[model samples]
Target: MTVNSVLVLGGGFTGLTSAIALALRGVENVTLVERAPAWARVGHGITVQGNALKVFQDIGVVDEILRRGFGADGVTLFHADGSVMMRLQTPKTGGEDLPATLGALRADVHEILVERALELGVKFRLGTQVVSFENHGDSVSVLLSDGTTEFWDLMIAADGIKSSTRPKLGITAERASSGLGIWRGVTNRLPEMTGGIAYPAPGDEGAYKVGYTAISATQCYVFVLCEPQRTPNDLPDWQEMKRLMEPFHGEFDWLRESLNESTYLNFQEIEWIFVEEPWHRGRVIALGEAVHAVPPLIAQGAAQCVEDALLIADYVTREGDLEAHLTEFQERRIPRIKGVVDASLQLAYWECHPGSPDAQPGRVMAQALAELVAAP
Candidate 1:
């Protein structure tokens, strides 16, 4: 295939990063299609680890991201009764010599990415969605929700966890629930909280896990995990979520109070999906949450997507054979990303069985695997 213009589906972090990367490599024509009426992020804060930070730096958006974000050196794990369990450090890697991790609102990061993509001359077609595509050997014809069709040399799907393009590509992956759901929010009042704390409870049925980090002195991000259940659609029922967090009321009183006072909260169900065999077919390729949607246990979901964008751009720009390039992309990333998925699942299991001395080994194993995969 003679590659020229590329069509990108979805305008989230992955889609934006992919477009920016393609433009940076001098790919003249690239169009980003988003289903939403406007470009916006739907979540609270996200943790950008070192590996992801490196990618951002390479893409020329790290400084802006860090300007609007906060960094942390390590994460501290605690028990439900305010007892310290473990403190894991995220040290800097050799390449960048920057901070270990960064925490920022999703909107800020998305804005930086979109701004860079726009600056690179990538076209943004918001309110437009790719309904279907016909791969015609040499080119792919993309059908948009606006009742228009366009042909492109390549198509990349960066749509999120519930991607509309996945089914059209004949990719079948089962998303398994992790038996735990999370309630996340950001508070303007600081309750004298410590940075990077992951607290696990004592049992499997109703274990409470909390992760706290300071976005600013007066602003804090808190994420609590509990048993999975149906949540009403109206404003995330902060009061009911407080009720579910009653067990940790006395233990992490500040967190409980934060939840009670928080006016904005979002509920997320933890799930993981594995796409069988090839990650790409013909001219259509799925990246980010569209390919492997894992739980937030490792906090590498978005980062891995960014890595995919960088690697894909590099492969296409350097390699002549398109099929061989896609094959190499899958082979190079599958084992590494799969290890991350497995390690995250293991950590989720350990969090489920907190306080038990037996779970310590699982935690240790997870940390080891993380280090191994995180290593350059």
Candidate 2:
């Protein structure tokens, strides 16, 4: 099957990378549509593991990303009183050629991808979405939010976890609330990069977990996790910071003092979805969060999205039956994605319900990190 024109829904990390990869390899007429008016993605920070860096290297943007982001060597776990519990060194999975982990402003990463896509002549139709999609035998007829209908040989739905295209194609993807809500903020970076810091829940602050990393030279992304039932609005003052920072007595003193109401804070409950049989229905295929949405415990959400784009681009450029290639693609992706998502969920579950005798504090983390050290 020869693919002429391609339409990608959502202008996210996955969509932009897909468009650029296809265009770089000579996939014609690749246009991406995004509902957002601009490329301002939500969230403050993202941690890209080594595997993600490997993918970025493949797309020819790893150096730019590394130049703008802070690469870390390891992570440190602390007890409530700032006592060192354990320090885990991050292995260089992308190989010794690249840093094992990188901490970046989510907006910076977004800008890099979007700018690269534009440089590669990827067209983006912003501020509109897909209204309807009809899959013909050889091509797909899609109605846009602007009342214009277009045709494409293939349509890639990378429209995030709450994707509009999945249900329209009669795919039953179940998304459930993970019962954990996280509070995130950007604060002044410490004088030194103390690797990454994590404090487990059921602490002095009442079942709250916190993790923070230096995202840039002068700033850090801090996240405090709690039960989903708490209202984030009530946590707008410095008193809220005092409670959240009760665990760390030493290094966090300055970061706590840097908090104010003007500080940008975001709260979101973690939700997950793993769409079984995420493909197969004529000309449309799924990618990114639409197919496998997971918690950030393992920090593979964005990495997996990038991987999805790269793999799809690889298949689209190959000479073969598109459907057969897609079947093989799904086969290669589903198991790895399931393992990563399930491991993340298990760690989150143990955090929320810390009553299990079989669950250890850093055991799952160790195992999951090892599994991720090898490329998927």
Q: TM-scores across all candidates? A: 0.90, 0.94
The residue-by-residue lDDT of candidate 2 on 48-100, one tens digit each, is 88889998999999999999888887788776566777788876767788887
Prediction 1 global C-alpha lDDT = 0.75
Q: Which window of 10 residues has the lowest lDDT sum in candidate 2?
A: 198-207
> Ten-residue segment with the worst summed lDDT in candidate 1?
198-207
Report the lDDT tens digits of candidate 1 across residue range 26-59: 7879899887888656668787777788889889
What's model 2's lDDT at 207?
38
**CA shift of 206, model 1, Å:** 3.4
